[model samples]
Target: MTTSEHGAVPGLFTLVLHTHLPWLAHHGRWPVGEEWLYQSWSASYLPLVRVLRALAAENRTHLLTLGITPVVAAQLDDPYCLQGMHHWLANWQLRALEAATTRTASGPSPASAPEALRRFGSREHAEAERELVEFDAYWRHGASPVLRELIDGEVIELLGGPLAHPFQPLLHPRLREFALREGLADAGARFAHTPRGIWAPECAYAPGMETDYAAAGVGHFMVDGPSLHGDTALGRPVADSDVIAFGRDLQVSYRVWSPKSGYPGHPAYRDFHTYDHATGLKPARVTGRQVPSADKAPYDPDRADAAIDGHVADFVDTVRKRMRAESERIGRPAHVVAAFDTELFGHWWYEGPEWLARVLRALPAAGVRVGTLSDAVRGGYLGGRVDLPPSSWGSGKDWQVWAGERVADLVQLNNEVVDTALTTVDKALARAAAVGAPTPRNPVADQILRETLLTVSSDWPFMISKDSAADYARYRAHLHAHATREIAAAAAAGRQEQARRLAEGWNRADGLFGALDARRLPVA
Candidate 1:
């Protein structure tokens, strides 16, 4: 017989979500900026927050560990972002209104009446208005409150990363410290909770980052196990530091979804691409006999409930088997953490909320205890020493996904931009202090500092790696490059006027990293 019932396991399963988006507000829209924020807010943030709130209301303790990178948090809390998101929701209402007017007057799906449908106050407009009204209320009223409540209640563990979410592994060592230290401080101030852990952007890792983590007062960090230098199975404390490193559990992590294959790709699921251009709602089928996106299909909760039940059963069973085997070898409770991007739920995996809710409810009923990484570590689980290989949860768990030759141009741009940033920081630090003002925690200079951190965000490289919106990545690179180059030039020449102008320009455009101060950088 199995050592557990209902497929419950003897290990800790930490469900982690890394939520990050670059500072896009005040930049542009449609192809970037406000649009990006609204899209993710609608697709991922609102729904994920709702899931957490529901779980919290049920008194689910330590439900999930979430890493909300500093940049995304900045966007969320920014006044401009606050207004823009609200306005975006409002505009969505207006569009729905417009669509309804057109349909009512022109007749639905009629080539002859297409012109009439485009005008105001048409005949078939009420349904579109309703959809918009619901969307606005769900996001503004439902999701926003849940997000704040989850944070304040301490129901979900929050994690942060370097400002603008840079790839620390290859970032300039100096700038890495600049980004992460400032980011943690910002999160603490904004959320009223200090993060002891961080989700390194892109699961990127390099040796010697632990020292920076320690210096920044960070006690723990998460990376793909392979990136730990071989500590794949559990969170391992780095040598000579209280900071702990946890790796992603591939066995269980892969079961739900992977970069290559997962339940999302199942023929029955809705297609992520290919929306009806006219209606902008998905209205097609993935497989031959699959459910069509359009038609009166109103998201049958029963069908979804059954699918979740089956998946949860299989998941619990797998955990039980793993637990028994680990107990035999380790003679104690082994820990497991399955890490994933938060966007996978409502955004990418439409039915992910159902699956998560069911799995969480069933795990405990099955005898497996659900917990976070901190609890497992504090509970006194000992991990054997092992050298983790270099791995990421990216495509192929390798650098080929991001740094491959196809992205040589982007890589070169990063190298140049970072070097410029380092130089800018040094020069700015030397020029002046705020006349006995307290030295900032980050050593990077003002304009030079903010621009540099934003420039190095892992998002640009990640987007380029996936070839998703290469245009946006290119635009972001040049934007930062200009700032980095300009700020350093002004600091070097002691041209306060020019420096202030460039800084102000950046300020108008910069959405995060407001805490960056050049006096923190040590002279080199």
Candidate 2:
């Protein structure tokens, strides 16, 4: 085992943040589409990166492992998205100004015009100005440059994943392999740094995926704690494969946020659902669980700031205790990995970014070793080997959220589209080979594969099962599936001109990955 300067303190701590969203650009915008991207970019990505840059300036390296899925990275680098995000930020500032004017002209009492609205307006206006400066200075070129700076400086380890976030366990073998390789290639092209590890979509895995990962040059991946039978203090090699699987420590992770209870539920934090009808801003605090949103108290930044300190301390203590206890039990320096969606910071929980910053800074002072997942493996924190079953970080710790009875129809639709697309592409390739011609680099077939991959995204089924934006999720799935069918039909009928027109239309609408090639599919 490798030794640190502290000479075997309590244990190691690794934070993994998975960043992802479906191909939302050029789709819809309001209610659920590109708006999701802009909001997250403004609230989460910008502020979080600023925090990291601050920490890096202080010479703190290897702060966390960041997974930016290929599809989301595509959107971040898209010309259309950058322009739309700038416009969105400018509009946010205008809206804040309008809210301030409205409040000043007609001064209402505390009951009518809560203090939270005014405070929120001022805060948003200031933030918009600050973010606009950052965007013009750093992000106007796209997120790749910003991300590359961090990776190059050793401030963060980048984890990548498949082209679209497909549920790998259910995907056909050939398509799954193609997606994984292409996704890594896309990331390499964007960052100029091929990731040695990846955040498997949904942390979903089936037996024998290790061989594929190994072939793709992935050294490690993340899985849920239960997948390792609840002993998650150390990484474990998957059934004799050198590829390591790190289990997320739910104990330390759940301290920040969980389904039932967490720090975000504190009374002082901003309420996520309740919004001011006029200003479209969250103006109420989560005063009480049963309290109606209207009756909730106005959000006080001071109170929330105090809550953030408390939560940070609580999280640090929890990590320390878990690591110490696990180290003693295992008779070695153990590691605890706490993973979460990167958007949770500043997007869902307003105080999350502050909490994260404080926690990272405090952990090292509290004698906790802060490192990335790669550090854990290199430092010999991997445990014994075992065969991992099909698992996901979902409800019931299985594939219920994506492939359960509730989403059976979507599951069937996804399978049919995938099968049809694959067969059509394979037949086209064979026709070219049989005629003693060069293999066809068919753009139509490539677009069909792209549509098929988008249709199988885990988001649709998860949203439908959870009853959150079920209609939008269904619309996206069916829309992509229909596109795949149309393109495949045109190709099958030998209508080259029609196929080219249809493909170009779809390409303009749903295009993200320009490097995607249909020739990657295995021979039929």
TM-score of each: 0.84, 0.96
Error of 2 at 33 (Å): 1.2
lDDT (tens digit, per residue) of candidate 1 on 1-524? 23254454666767888887777876778756678778677657766665676788888778888898877777776767766777765565555455544443222222213342343223224433443454566544333244556767767787878887776766767777777878888778776777888887777666667778999988777777556543345567766566788888677787888657666665545456534344443322233234433331222334555666677788877766666665666677777778888778766766677677777777788777777767777776546543434545577666665678777776777788778767766555444454476644432257677777777677777787888887888788778878878867875677767777777777777735666665555455
**For all the candidates, what are their Cα RMSDs to the real structure?**
5.2, 2.7
Clashes of 2: 0
Q: What lDDT would each prediction earn against the true structure?
A: 0.66, 0.89
The 10-residue segment of model 2 with minimum total lDDT is 103-112
Candidate 1 worst ten-residue window by lDDT = 104-113
lDDT of 2 by residue, 1-524 (tens): 12343234576899999999888988898899999999999989998999999999999999999999999999999999999999999998887766555544222223126344666678778888999999999999899999999999999999999988999999998999999999999999999999999999999999999999999999999999999998998898898699999999999889887899999899999888776666666667888888786576777889999999898878877887898899999999899999999999988998888888998898887778999999998899988997998999999989999999999999899889999999999987778779896776888888999999999998999999999989999999999999999999999999978988999999998887889989888665
- Best model per lDDT: 2
Give the Å error, residue 189, model 1: 0.6
What lDDT would candidate 2 get against the real structure?
0.89
